[model samples]
Target: MIDGALFVVVLVGALVCAVSAGALYAFSSFVMKGLTALPPAQGIAAMQAINRAAPGPAFMVAFLGGALLSAVIAVFTLVSWPGEGGPLLLVGCALYLFGMLGISAVAHFPRNDALDKVDPEAPASAAYWRDWAREWTRWNHIRTAAALAAATLFVLALVR
Candidate 1:
């Protein structure tokens, strides 16, 4: 039998993973699509507001916290190595830790941070906005796919 506490950890990790997936889904589906409809400057302004607010405590919990929790899941899974859940959890670890969070930390954050430093009203910010938004959304698509996959695997892990 799976340890109750460890099962709880897996379930909670799955839930947190879902939150990350959902956010990426929203961004992939409507958020970026909506942003594309606006003039680049307006889009940049909206994105700036979003980027600014995103690092706040609540989102950070879901964002960075989920990643950290997933790392815990990965480590615990390695140590405990539950029967059917083992491989699934390992796969989830790769997807969540490297695929989702890795891409976010490595690719997305730097881009956002760079954009944050630029003046949105400047003549150059338009091009920067266009490039940044497009690239960010592309990377976001990767995040969405990886997170969704991880979530599915986690669910499987939970049941096993």
Candidate 2:
């Protein structure tokens, strides 16, 4: 039926988005490691440099792309969610959507906005930079988890 076909497309899109999120998560870890390894003074400098570069645009692109894909999956799942395994797929899709949107709106976007105006070469206190990095990493972890959850759900929907 048409519903089944739509479901298939959504599932594939969800899986692709999930994979992309995982790749982004890995990149985040790499950035964290690089930041953590620096001496306090250099770390602050590096953080400022990164912020000034406006890394937020990249996150926004990724977040929006994933969200759009997940929305498609959610819509299709909703349309045909009365059959066998349909409810499960719906729940999974909902979780993924909620999680992705929540993190983007609550954590990532705020940090990105804050980073936009920071001066790269201006002297910053160590505590401030340390706290900021920790916060960023924490949100990154949330995003990664949500992406994984979304992938798992899509895979389940495909199998069932």
Candidate 3:
């Protein structure tokens, strides 16, 4: 029963990580490009709107829910220390929880918060918009990679 529950959790965690990676990939792939191509004010306004809208239910479910699931998987792995799947479970949880969520908290949110403080139409805001888009997208790539990697690890754990 415990094994069955752990398997379900791992499966859900993998799916969540994949969903997160897909969302981040969209930003890194085209969303940032499309937004940045606009005039600075327009781009800034759009990004600010996106940031404002990001904290709602669906995203919170994937983002926070993924973290919560990862934490559970980590605890389970530590407690049981199963032969084959244990290391994968631990690493996958760590990568998703720390690499994806941790980077977002430490690197991305600060920039988003700073962007919120600036006037979208201001000259300084224009310069900052360019810099922000570049830096934010770069960091997002890292997040995308982490989530994708976590998903892969979880799937591997499932197979093993």
TM-score of each: 0.92, 0.75, 0.96
Q: In candidate 1, where is summed lDDT lowest over 10 consecutive residues?
A: 1-10
Q: In candidate 3, where is summed lDDT lowest over 10 consecutive residues?
A: 1-10
Identify the superior model by TM-score, candidate 1 or candidate 2: 1
Alpha-carbon shift of residue 13 in model 2 (angstroms) = 2.3
lDDT of 1 by residue, 4-109 (tens): 7778877877888889889889998999889878887788888878999998987778777668878888888888765658888889878988889999999898
Ranking by TM-score: 3, 1, 2
Off by over 4 Å in 2: 1-4, 39-62
Residue 60 in candidate 1 has what lDDT? 75
Clashing pairs in 3: none
lDDT of each: 0.83, 0.66, 0.90
Per-residue lDDT of model 2, residues 33-150, tens digit only: 7877787567666765665664476655555666776677667656656665566566656656677667767886677667545554456645666777788788777777777777
Clashing pairs in 1: none
Please report the TM-score between candidate 2 and the true structure.
0.75
Could you tell me which residue pairs clash in candidate 2?
Answer: none
Report the CA-based lDDT of candidate 1 relative to the real structure. 0.83
Is candidate 1 or 3 superior in TM-score? 3
